[model samples]
Target: MKKSLIVSFILSAFLVTTLSGCGSTSTAVSGSTDTKVPATAKTEKSTTLRIGYQKYGTVNFLKANGELDKVLKEKGITIQWTEFPGGPQLLEAMNVGSIDVGHTGEAPPIFAQAAGTPLVYLGHEPASPASEAILIPEKSEIKSVAELKGKKVALNKGSNVHYLLVKQLEKAGLKYEDIQVVFLPPADARAAFEKGSVDAWVIWDPFFSAAETSAKAKILADGKDTVANHEFYLATRSYAQSNPETVKTLLEQLAKVDTWSKDHPKELSETLSPQLGIDVPSLERAAKRRTYGIQPIDDALLSEQQKIADSFFKLGLIPKEINVKDAVLPATK
Candidate 1:
């Protein structure tokens, strides 16, 4: 009799909830949390938020003129966008408090945090090792990673490729000091690699793809096992915590653009090509290889990121080990 009474009560509650949820237009957070908003109700505004982004990373026109801006605009907030060449520079800007939010890859944030940069990882993206690599001239004599010893390799120092080259050398049983590291920007490195000044170029796509097709560069090795090459959305801890409401809407919009980009790769390239001034073909090539979804800052992801920083320390690229979770916002987990 007691079991039957409990079952009856449960069924009654389910029936009530089922009927109450009929034709719902807004997502209800909980039984008591109000989610319904009148059409005339304006979303309350919040603090000023500045977002930074690089040309080749996730922050293209997606933040500049797309739905993210529109989403935030709807909430009566304003966003200021600052552009960067690479993650290292962007982190530099962040460390100096030039901006509050930006997107970068795994390695730069690791290096930046090691050097006492104050950026925090808010979230991440799906891992894709193919996004970064080491490219050589197609007909070059360097057939194996071992042959890179004493060879001039051009790379952006302290960027994602910095750790990649270290791991590549270690895989070949070579010490980090065995190779001549030529630190160069992407543009200068392309020129130097083309002029035969460097034996190989360690770079990320669409530069890697361009080097393969137009520059006739061969990929000697890629991020395989060395990295997952996951893109990270970082922000100032103070900024993210103080402006949760603004950040929440902005992240949702980012996820929205990511979903749309996945379904419409060609559309994404067509939209970004003109802004980047890099032709549709190159943009399309990049879009094909990249995975565009933001990830919550789960423990597993943080563990992997910590390993990345630890590896840099083991290889002597960094003087001391950094607790990656410390740099991560407290609300990160």
Candidate 2:
């Protein structure tokens, strides 16, 4: 199936899988939605903790360290890691109960919430505004954001770059309808952009880094100048509420890995090069574009997430308004 068609099907089925026997909601003490794990579930002591992660990012770093395996093994729990192409797909797996915890860019959670997926915000990475970009071919005559008007632009629908593209267009005094958006995932979009099938492509690293070097693409704008591009960690409502200690342990391990990643980018890149199948320098370059820190969900973070929810709703991209605060896990003491 075409990528777009597959994405559409996933989006359409999102609520169906989430609401139909997959999840149940309880009223929390704070009046938030507390989604409980499905009943025919194994105990925390009996089952493996399934974590879905994108091919790059923190989970890859965590997997490389191998500490998570040793730690979980002590608790009679094993780790099962699933790789996803991006956040949207990762969250789809979560909604279907295929994975218990995952990480994604800021936008996916908002889309998931709007689709009625029972998810909780577990944590987030500090904003790394330069990690994503809007690129025009090196020789393209379209120079400024305004020039994108009436042109075909390629990007993954509902991805982080989708929010970036929307905000950038508004900043350029263009309406959502002003440009032609061709919704394609990164690989296909890169192909379209290189062949001049799409005039511009909005994407995130390490794909953004790879394209900049391999395709010699020139950046028209980057997230640094436009949006607060924060990546988030999430869990199915049931999993987080039932496994608080496991969640805390996961966060602790992630923090150590993130701190180490910052201090050893070259070494980190060399280690990840084989796993990601990218050259060291490109991975190192991608490393330079990110900020590595994890933070708990808070009001300030929810405010930023609210902005994303509102933007999509305004654009008619999401079906309804989303209250980001309601989906956040209660503060851990």
Candidate 3:
């Protein structure tokens, strides 16, 4: 009996020890009170500024120069570039958080604002009214914007050219409905223009220059006496609000590039030719038509933007009216 009692006591002691060890391990894993994290376990979040750009513009020039990247790197901000087919597409990317900063023509931002995209205008290039135009084939009989009545017109909807078309029609004393509008992107529009599928194609350079050179398109009317055709630099509202200094740095760099580009049209064309896959002659023509010099958004520009918005809303292009000033970058104190 005593031997059996001793064996029972030994077994009980072993059970207690094993159970206690398991309880301790369980507490350590699931119920520990320690709150300190190790130095190696901590990580600093990295910041990357995503920039959206189209094929031909100041942004493209900026990207090709590599100067902006070097400047940004010194400030611990890395740049990620995404190329979009046009301004509308670039702003669409901005609306979806794919890009933080981008450049676009005047009309895309109006549509974006109406659709509730949180975008703000950071700056604008001087109005290059002659840069965009309504072009007809060289062999075509169309002589004036007034002659476009009941004819088929092709343009990229919601582009800067859209407003130009509207204003041109109004100037010709023709209703917007008078012309049968065909919406197509630059490549398709160029194809249509070549195949005689479109009566006239409203476009901007370097496509304008390309069409003139290769497709034998002639300018019917340009924005010279009509629209401002301002090229705008834009950013997500959150980004501009949070990174004001970065935005300022970008505009400053663009200003410097603009000054350089104005004096070196030949060099600009040569530099952009290989990158754009366009001939130097065509690019040179485009460079001449283009105006450079970045300017801050001001009351006068806002009034012009508001006019565009009002016109679009009146024409039922955008669903709702939007205040242009609402999308301007908040003035820094």
TM-score, every prediction: 0.83, 0.86, 0.85
lDDT of 1 by residue, 1-333 (tens): 343343333233323322232323233222344343234422333456788888776666376446777667777777788887788988889898898889888889998898887666666778878878898987799999899999999998788888788888888999888999999988889999999999999998777777776877888999878778888888765565455556666666666677777778788778777777666777778788888766666578889889888888997888899998777432333
Give the distance in Å from residue 50's predicted Cα in candidate 2 to where it truly belongs.
Answer: 0.8
Q: Judging by lDDT, tell me the better candidate of 1 and 2.
A: 2
- The best-first sequence of candidates by TM-score reads 2, 3, 1
Candidate 3 lDDT at 175 equals 90
Candidate 1 error regions (>4 Å):
1-46
| Residue-wise C-alpha lDDT for candidate 2, range 1-333, written one tens digit per residue | 443343333222322323332334433333444545457633343257899988678878998889999998998889999988888888888888899999899899999888888888766778999999999998999989999999999998888889999989989999989999999977899899999999999999888888888889999999876799988878887676566567667877887898899889999999988887777887889898899877655568788889889989988999999889878643320
What local lDDT score does residue 95 receive in model 2, on the 0 to 100 scale? 85
Higher lDDT: candidate 1 or 3?
3
Query: What's the lDDT for residue 279 in model 2?
Result: 78
What are the RMSD figures for all models against the true structure? 10.5, 8.8, 20.8
RMSD of 3: 20.8
